[model samples]
Target: MPVVLQAGSFGRIRLIYVLVQYVDETPKFGHTAVDSSSGTPILNSSAAGVSPPTPAFTPSHYSHIYGSTPETLTTIDAPKNYGHAPWPRISPREACLLRYFIEELSRWFDLTDPHNNFATSIPQRARSNPILLDAILAASARHFSTLPSDQKAHIMSHYGLSPLPSHIHDSNSELSITEETVIHYHSRCIAELRVLANEPHAVMDEDLLAAVVVLRFFEELDNPFTSPPTETALHGLHVFLRAQASSALLVPGPRQASFWIGFRQEFNLAFSQQRNTNLPLEITDSYLIFTGAEDHVWTNRLVVLGARVLEFSYGSSPSNDLEFNELVRLRDEWVDKRPRSFAPIYTESPDMDTAFPKIWYTDDSHITAAQTLLLINILLLAYSPSIPRIGPSRRQTLESIDAQIRTIVLEICGMALSNRQSRPAGLTACIAINLCADRFTDPQEQRALMGLVVGTTRDSNYWPTKEAERRLRGIWGWDGDDD
Candidate 1:
């Protein structure tokens, strides 16, 4: 008889491993006898009156024990080759299972997808799979390399790629270059083309090339790898060529005229604002400097340019011959008003012949004293019409006045120096005398005239005389006469 083991008889049986078997005979439950004390199997279930120990009713016994015979197991439960289980082969089903596992694991691990794919559409499991990622990249490179050169080039251009010659020669090498590297190389090419476009001798076709390069550059501007080109760089290139042509014109060369024409054309285009304003003097000055035209002649030209600017902006005319003459006249009038003589001291009311003469002043008291002021005044006069007009040919009249006053001052100084009797006169006296002196004159009479200007005094009126003497002393660097 076969014995049956009850479910609760064995304390919860844990399944360590499972082996399935198939039966050739009617599946009779069997048991084997074991040494009771030692718990050793001493007898087989096939022995007389000893049937296989009744199989347990547990799920593990049904799955492992009943299918124990190798041949029977092969028929009932297909045997798996534990030594050579196929791996690294992920079917679509397996992929889905893997992705699901990842999603569940990510939740448990608190990992997140930066692309938010997990929150939106499920990512293709192959995309997230490491083994699939390498396969995809390799396959992409192979497909791209298989394309015809022209087609490849077109595609690359669209994507702003510039594959190196070596990359083209070797498909493996192309794999090394990434989208970012391609963009960087293309940007460098565009920058180089922009520089070439500004070269005066750059081929006409180069413009087309530069345009293409710029187009590529613009396309890639949105790429994180490509920095946007600056407007200043473009404008600077255009301006640089114009300046180069202008510089060539300043040199003695056969291309001078042609260069200048080109320069002006380019300049007008590049600086339309200045051209529209008729090229103001400041702009002209800047142009000259940019063209490296630094010379004294250029300096003078700039001054003339400034004058022209003043005329243009302020509605003043450039100085003419008549205006120049007027400047001279103004300068002379300023010189002629200087005093040449000081009053003399008298002991008594002098006799008529010897009485102190009246002091006369010239129009100008000193030489070169009013020169700078005169120049500034001339500049003002030339520029400012509000200043009173002096004469008939307003110009000639001002000039004549200037000359007359200047002559008077020169004459006074001459006489004062000629008549000097004691000490040399102070600056005011010298200036005054020089203004009054004769143009042809002697130094002695000039000095004598200066001393007379010092004046005579009477002792009886000592206080007033002293006061006057003190004043004169201040002028002449002297102490007043003592009692």
Candidate 2:
């Protein structure tokens, strides 16, 4: 006879077992039941023709058979082109972006307020702000990984992130690294410095330090792989140093000198090492002074320096052999006409007519040749390696010229700052006047010349005292003012 298990309970015999043990093996057996109380089989129906007792279906049967409920199955179907490239690595651009974001955020915490440095600002805050920093790092790495190796390297170099040390490993577990990774690391350094700078309770001196750090980083950006820095980097460093030295920190003594010397040395090295022959003269001068030891080179350097000093003091170009002479002649002529006041350095000769032609009479007639010479002299004075010679008489003259130049530059700066009416031509004229002051030697004479350039009467908006004071402070030097 066949047997059946009770409903909602696991039985010794299931459908397959029942078929195997009874129907398949013993065809003569009909319906049968297995009693739960006793492990014994009981006939319920006869033979194959009779029906067996119905059994109830319950959760326990399925539970024992299949275990627990099956969880919702999930699988990611990546696109067909998904494996084209390996997972992206961190990049320099992303690093820079991350740094920028963090520094900007830190600004909100009043980092500049000397009383609140980073520690005091958030005493309980965790070290490194890992959460934010990691997010930035991950995002940057992903974005940069999409770019080509060379492009990534270039950007990394720009951010000072390339040529990373062996310790900064990537996923391949390989020690070999790409330039882009180094650049990203550099950006991280910058961002870290920026955070420090932004910390409240930062000392006044820290501001200067921050400026120096930024300048140094920029200098590094010019060339990443090479030890020698580029001209662009040198120029940028000089500009920053000049500005910083002139700021409230007053970096004038040995510190300033040391910075300049280092700058000059690096600049020279770059010039000498450069493969390009068509490098600029200024860059060449920068290199030669450091690498070459010839007396003649020193002489040339002195001359250049002297010329620059004179230009800054007098607002006149002494290097222009022709214009220098013409300027002297013009000054003499003007002195002769108005002996009471100093002669104008520049004047129009009604007798001569050419494109922007004006005879600049100097102590000598040869100084009035070409405008190009004048322009060149001006450029040299503005960006020269030489220093000026000072004597009581010359110093007095320089002071006068500097004052006049300051007055003019301040006016132009003010105009630009105001964002007022269109004053493009006026600003250009002001810059030209400043260049003239940079080249000239006699302060009184330069002022007079500047007056002539500005057409005698001063503008109503021109407040000389306040403007001069502001500019002097901006330049971080009191020497410009005659007072």
lDDT of each: 0.30, 0.32
For TM-score, the strongest prediction is 2
Each candidate: RMSD: 44.8, 32.6
Indicate the residue-level lDDT of 365 in model 1.
18
Question: Candidate 2 — what's its lDDT?
Answer: 0.32
Q: Per-residue alpha-carbon lDDT of model 1 for 1-483, expressed as tens digits?
A: 121111111012111001122111221113343322123332222333433344333333436666654454435644332443222322222232234323331221111112232212222332322222222222233223334556546644554556455434532333233343232223322333333443444322322222222222222222211122223222322333333434433543322222222222222122211112112233334432313332222322322233332333234443444654553453343234322221222223223343122323221112112222322332344344443456457767555555544444443333333333211112223323222233213334333443444431110100112333333344444444421
- Please report, as a residue range, the 10-residue window in candidate 2 with the lowest summed lDDT: 9-18
TM-score, every prediction: 0.14, 0.21
**lDDT of candidate 2 at residue 126, scale 0 to 100:** 13
